[model samples]
Target: MELDGNALGGDLSSVFAADVTGAVFVCAGCQHSGVVASLRVWVPAPGLVGRCPNCTDVVLRLVRTPTRAFLTLTGASRLELPLD
Candidate 1:
């Protein structure tokens, strides 16, 4: 399923399912995307800290830190609406 920006908040367990090895966070504003390794850390929450691959913009990092499941999207400062 395509994850919309609005559906990003809350617990991210479902987003980082057991079978999901990783995920790519694509920026809606610039189409920048980044790959996140999902097996490295256990993500207690759904947020992270990084920059966009395409735009080099600071992203609101969403991560399952324990499993290393993570993604970086354009922050609310860069967008007009809340990401979730």
Candidate 2:
């Protein structure tokens, strides 16, 4: 199943002070840049994974538990968030 970055809005919001879905992510693997909303997402495993559309690099990962949420942004070289 494929989802978009918006699918992480609810869970990611819990950890981030800003809205993650509107943030722009730069792919570290291929230097591709795009908004999180445009990434190809896969949510079938224990976590949520968002990959780059241009290079298929994993840009976002979210793992949620009853007590904690683990987010990994290793595939992203930069993240630009909305000011307001």
Candidate 3:
């Protein structure tokens, strides 16, 4: 999915393509420029938060959706799916 540029804290977000290769990239907010390993993505329970691998920054906040496939991020595009 295409991330909103305004949602990113800085230019680092620009480097991330919507079609992520599941490879974790370095966090621009921190000095640690090492490659992110073991990248994992999942829908978490209520109150759970997603964090950056390099700097442990809270990147995504989880929320409930009406459908199993609500959003799709692929090939530099963001697609919203209807509830099925």
Candidate 4:
């Protein structure tokens, strides 16, 4: 079964100051751009992973602990977020 980016809502909201599901993510590997909500997500991984829909490249990674959360966007060339 496949899951969409919305599955990361609780996890993402914990790290970002704003709702980032609507943010645009540009894939570094294929230069494909899409909304965060549109990315494919894998929650069963060691952590949460969001991948580009067009190229199947990882776009974002999130790992959370009891007191800390780590987010990496190495696969994303750019992330455009809404101002409001």
Model 4 scores a C-alpha lDDT of 0.90
CA lDDT scores, all candidates in order: 0.42, 0.87, 0.32, 0.90
Q: lDDT by residue for model 4 over 1-84, one digit each (tens)? A: 579988878899998898899889889999998889999987578888998999898899999999999999999999998997
Give lDDT for model 1: 0.42
lDDT of 2 by residue, 1-84 (tens): 887778878888899898888889999999998888888888688888889989898888889989989989999999999896
The candidate maximizing TM-score is 4
Q: Over the stretch 9-70, how does candidate 3's per-residue lDDT look in tens digits?
A: 22222344342233334443453332222222333344223345545554444343453312
Comparison by lDDT, 2 against 3, better one: 2
Q: Report the lDDT of model 3 for residue 32.
A: 35
- The stretch of ten residues in a row with the least summed lDDT in candidate 4 is 41-50
Give the runs in model 3 whose Cα sits over 4 Å from its true position: 1-28, 31-44, 67-84
Residue 53's C-alpha lDDT in candidate 3? 50
TM-score of decoy 3: 0.30
Q: Which portions of model 4 miss their true places by more than 4 Å? A: none
